[model samples]
Target: MTGAPTPVSPQQIPAAYQQALRLQNAGQLQQAAQIYAAILRTRPLAEPCFQLGLISARTGRRAEAATWFRRALEIKPRQIEIWTALIDVLDGPERAKAMAEAQRLGLIPSDKSAAAMRKALAELETGDPRKADRLYRKALEAGGDPVPLRETWARALFDRTETDAALKVLAEGLAKAPADPRLLLTRASLLETAGRIDEAEADLLAVLDARPYHPLAWLALMRARKQPPGAPHVATLEQRLPEAAADPEATRYMSFALAKALEDQKRDAEVFAHLDRANTMTRRKFPWNFEADHGFLRDAIAAWTPRTRGQSGAAPIFVTGLPRSGTTLVETILAAHPQVAAGGEAAVMTPLLHPAVEAWFSKGTDYDAQAIGQAYVAGMARKLGAASRDCRTTDKSISTYATMGYALDTLPDARFVVLERDRRDVGLSIYKNLFRDGTHRYSNDLTDIARQIRLFDAAVAAWRKRIPDAIHIVDYEALTADPEPHVRALLDFCGLPWDPACLTPERTERQVHTLSSVQVRQPINRGSVGAWKRFEGALQPLIAALDATRYDFG
Candidate 1:
């Protein structure tokens, strides 16, 4: 074997190199490179060199990559693949150069269709959607079976808020690929956005019937159920919850749907149970609360929060708590006020803290409190996107503020209206509703749901002890019973002028997408206050831990 490591043939290595090329095409770059490297150790090949250049171009290694492409072009002067790979790695000026070279070498046509697609993809990547749209259209005009081009065009249109055009594109695509689940889901979402809830629901159901485990179908179905006025559909949703309990995605929508249904029935405990389940499952899947991993979050808030501090302008109002709690209702009420823009579940603050969290993981250091605060404000501004300038103040009702220690620290000048519903009600509501995301950790089991509630309650109590002055605890029972007094007090806390509409959140036309979507559409009813008492027989375990005497609401 020693001397025979002699002259390894290119034929002997082509199999491995070809396999590497396949891997590269399939988006498995690193593995392909390793195989290519192995082959190069035995023999040099033009195909592997060209493929390596393509991989390098994709991964942003442009300079070193040009050398590989040149070497491949030299070895196979007439190869179209080498010329294409070289052009792919080039920037604007370099692309022009490569194209000129290809033309001179007679390798590819100057205005070939592949060239247009490459240019279009590059434009799309650089954020020029309008130009990219035109290029994609051009690619279709020059082409073969323009369905893929239509799909991309539709997505771009949707991104640019041309919903009607987007719908038309996908609707036509659906005519061709009627059974495609993704197309069906997209078409349904567009329909829902266009306020055709009935049509959306039909398409969504068609998708689910074909692919039973489709999570988006379940969520769209839940949304559709909310739009309609009926108990039968809600009952159907309730039955489907257990069927979808095991899948985390399914459980979210199930918990959300169940909570909405139970709330409509004025079953407070059941509503709370389903809502809490949705929250638990969501948190378990993706731990959004930055404070859970850092005690400094609690510490930062206590230190940074000034006793006599006030916001300069109308400050951002945070309506937050457990998922099934009255966070959405509180926001609906608050948003009815002329001064506030209700920015639903602003997902900004968490992402701002992520890099710091990751740094802590890497460097074994503590999170910078001042940096976090600045980042939070900036993050909120970013999520506000277009609406940041529209209103004097905005409201972000992210419901996951049960772990608000860090978020409170970040927005020291902001006002918080913390909604506190009964623990049993929270748990029951969470268990039944299908939340749209994986944040419902308690969706499957009763025991875990209750434990998560206890955790949230403890966290909130700790926040009260730490920063009591910063938070206004709005009891769900009190809010539902006499909404005006609480609503007025909340308005006062936010430093806003009151409107009577705050007491009647139902009349607001702000697209309420929460468990209280239906309830918030009605007059504040007293029936929901202690309605969980009816289910006391079924919720014994939840009641045992959630001492009714402590709340003193009887």
Candidate 2:
């Protein structure tokens, strides 16, 4: 077919293969595939064939992927990676045969250290950091290569809210491979959380300098700083879109990045266009379970017992509210106080509530309140580590509304700061961003987002009647408009001394790993107070579904 393939140079092929890998990793799948195919045309390279198989398998073309992988195996019969790819794309007898052959050829690493390292990573995914740490120690003791798993291990530590420990892990990783893109990106994220934006920017820039088209790095950089008009990144992001279409992950990152870039240039229409497409895809993939969530809230409220806070190690201050309703903002303000630890999105309660909800809903049984309080206190203290000592931990867990009344008995000494915002503004913010953590299905649809707000309102109203003294209502609009008096009152309610530092939450170095991370990094301002007015007509469906009152939506 091509006059002996023009006698392609073997040396030229490996460089092309690497360039294809960089493109694939960056999520530029279409371009990556073109190069891979071109390389295959010249030489039937096992690497390109295997990569193409992987791409096909990931995109759900399993049969085609299997064919490509088999073709790759024909070139290098004992190629372990090719066999692995074939196994994943095959089913029934073929998969079993492939698996057996792969094992026979040592496809899966069976060594103790390798197995331990693998389990350590899996444990991290399942949120068992203790188990992961144990496994990691086993791997290290067995002399496994730590460099490969360093980024993941550091992220696990960060997930536990052990920021210092996470940074220490990154330091060790960077010491070994200072220019490792993955480690640098991870450390950059950590540094950003630590309020070292300049350092984070430096790390991101270095990564980009090495691999200019990395989508995730571009997304991270986009969030860290403004993408001004005529900036090289703006055009690069735009041009990368057609190529990124085949990789949905790449498409999502580039879409959001480009949207942010356009917004920086005041291209409102284009910004919304990109957000709409990206959020639509996100909603499709991560649909929120609205009914189960609200059902739990209702049951928890119905099954509420009039109990007070227990004598706790450190009094828990829960900043409860809807997403994008200034919950993190309030927590940052409170965390500025010397005696408060910033516990962003405390997840300790999530597991406890699910079973509690099921028991209450189906069996009319109540979860043990005293045990919940004790467990929450102990777990939260462990999560915050040294910061929990003599400090009131401000846990801005967004779903605390579901169990605030239950906490009256379970978490008796816990102070609840009920943060409220204008429904319209909340709607706008939630619609524009993809919530990576929130299993909030309601956020996918405009009407559902509106309905959820009213549910939150009703829940808070019920809590106010039951536990008014324990609840401190903070109106986000009023607080942002005039912060000093509200912050003083907020601190007084939690029995904390007034630190003027709370007045400037932007200066607070608390880690905010949420959609509002970038916005909350700035000083409190009324800029977002009524920003919804700018898009009123486009958001009419959301407005109509709010069951609007002049007081509520206006």
Candidate 3:
């Protein structure tokens, strides 16, 4: 051996990597591999090793790819994309080992775009949206293809109530990548939220032209159009269901779309059948643990007592309840008032409360009430931008009902408006709606939905007892039947002066970002009040569960 091999300097790495990437992008795989190998000889860097692994796997050398991936991981253990690639090529004990390693490293299985998106989502779910926003921006800045990044980034922005910014991002993405189906689909949804139904419909139709059999596009088209009873598309939807059977997600989308069409046509049996299939698949894909959820609720209630006082502020009004239980209606009504801005489903509270609640449950540590309060204020300010500091706002995040105690303890002056609906109506509506988010896992199972309803009732009752003056109960039926008085009462409780505009919530120009987006645009009516009775036969499980729990619908 000639003394020792020459080593590459750190200064040369970036240029070399760029060259490798150029070669790879140009389809010169052999040249890229040679460069990668040369880089490896001088320095055992993870990027080169990862590239070598990708080339090997693509070229049918699975064993060699696995070896390179292993080397890459050894050099840089937190490479999620590498871990995912290795797992794909591995098998038997080796695959098990790689999986375990990935778990230990907290590496989710995904490619570049998917990994970034997943991490961002996980951050949002855990209540660190600021971190999630940073990650999303970082991904966008390091861009080659911008379509997927833009779509996800816009969603994150939208989730934080950055509605105008989200739309601008999507518009920019569309300008760069014209007619991209995903971008079109997402933009259409945003448009729908903004009450631009015609524009939303146009975008959806364009997506369908590009991807005719796209299940999500078809579903969005149905919703945007809001086809009347016995529309011709009912048959088309029925026929396409079989074509979509091979893909579970596609099948779920088609099923829900078809059920909506059938419901419009008065085919209750077919509607129920399709709903059942869709819900069943959704439940299987994302199982819900009733006991765990109940335990968390109990812990939350137990951790915060009546004596706990929160840091006071000009508290934002919270409109919360089960999905489809008039939260949107209440928010729309309130937002119509000049002093109130509707912060549609801002997920600021629960995430801010998570760490404190966990500490209480695990180590018996008392919640940092003031810290939680400050965090919520800061988080909402970020989400709402200028709007956060504006006049009173309402956060219509329905799940906040579960964390009411934490919320009360954090923002002592905060007002909560808990919405109640006919139990059966709530159950049926939840089952029918194709919720875009993943949090409502209990919606797909009747017994689970009923149990959740009972839990919600119990939690609300407990809160009522603990802080009767702070919480206001609004029944959906009562609100719709006599909207004026109920709305006046709501305004009074929140300490707002009466205004005539609050009575015409449907005419409010603000965006309604929920399943009830379309419905909230129309005047309040009793049409949906007891509509669940029409499908009583198909909702026996829900009825029985409600009966067992002694919830009086009458």
RMSD of each: 13.6, 8.1, 13.8
**Alpha-carbon deviation at 532 in model 1, angstroms:** 2.3
Worst ten in a row by lDDT for model 2: 1-10
Cand. 1 TM to true fold: 0.57
Q: Report the lDDT tens digits of candidate 3 across residue range 1-554.
A: 12333444555655565577678868899878777776677667777889889998998999999999989889867657888999999889999877766654434322454667667766764557688877666655543456667777787677656678888989997887778877899999988988888988888878877766688887887776566776766676777777654335667888888888777777777788889988876876577887777877787777666535567875889999988888898899999888887788888787778767878876898767887788777766666666656688789988788777678878888999999999999999999978874778899998888888998888888778777898998989998888888988989999999999988888998777677888889988887889898899988999999878732111
Which is the leading candidate under lDDT? 3
| Shift in Å, residue 536, candidate 1 | 1.9
> Of 1 and 2, which scores higher on TM-score?
2
lDDT of residue 419 for candidate 2: 84
Q: Ten consecutive residues with minimal summed lDDT in candidate 1?
A: 545-554
- Report residue 546 deviation for candidate 3 (angstroms): 0.8
For candidate 2, the lDDT comes to: 0.76
lDDT of 3 at 8: 46
Clashes of each: 50, 6, 0
CA lDDT scores, all candidates in order: 0.63, 0.76, 0.79
Tell me the tens digit of each residue's lDDT in model 2 across 98-150. 77666544444336667887888776655567888889878656643455456
For model 3 the local lDDT of residue 281 reads 69
**Model 1 over residues 1-554: C-alpha lDDT tens digits?**
12222333555563564466568768888888877666656766565676677777778899768878988878767667678877877789988988877765444533554567667766764557678767876775664445545656565455434677788878887887787776778777666654556788888888878866565676667655433445665666666766653244566666765666565556655666666666655655444443352344333333333323222333577777777777877887877877676666666555665555445545655665566666555555544434456564445545335435455545557667778888777766665555554455444455656655665566567677766777888988988877788888888887778789787776776644455555666677665566566666767767775553221100
Model 3 ranges with Cα > 4 A deviation: 1-141, 153-168, 307-309, 550-554
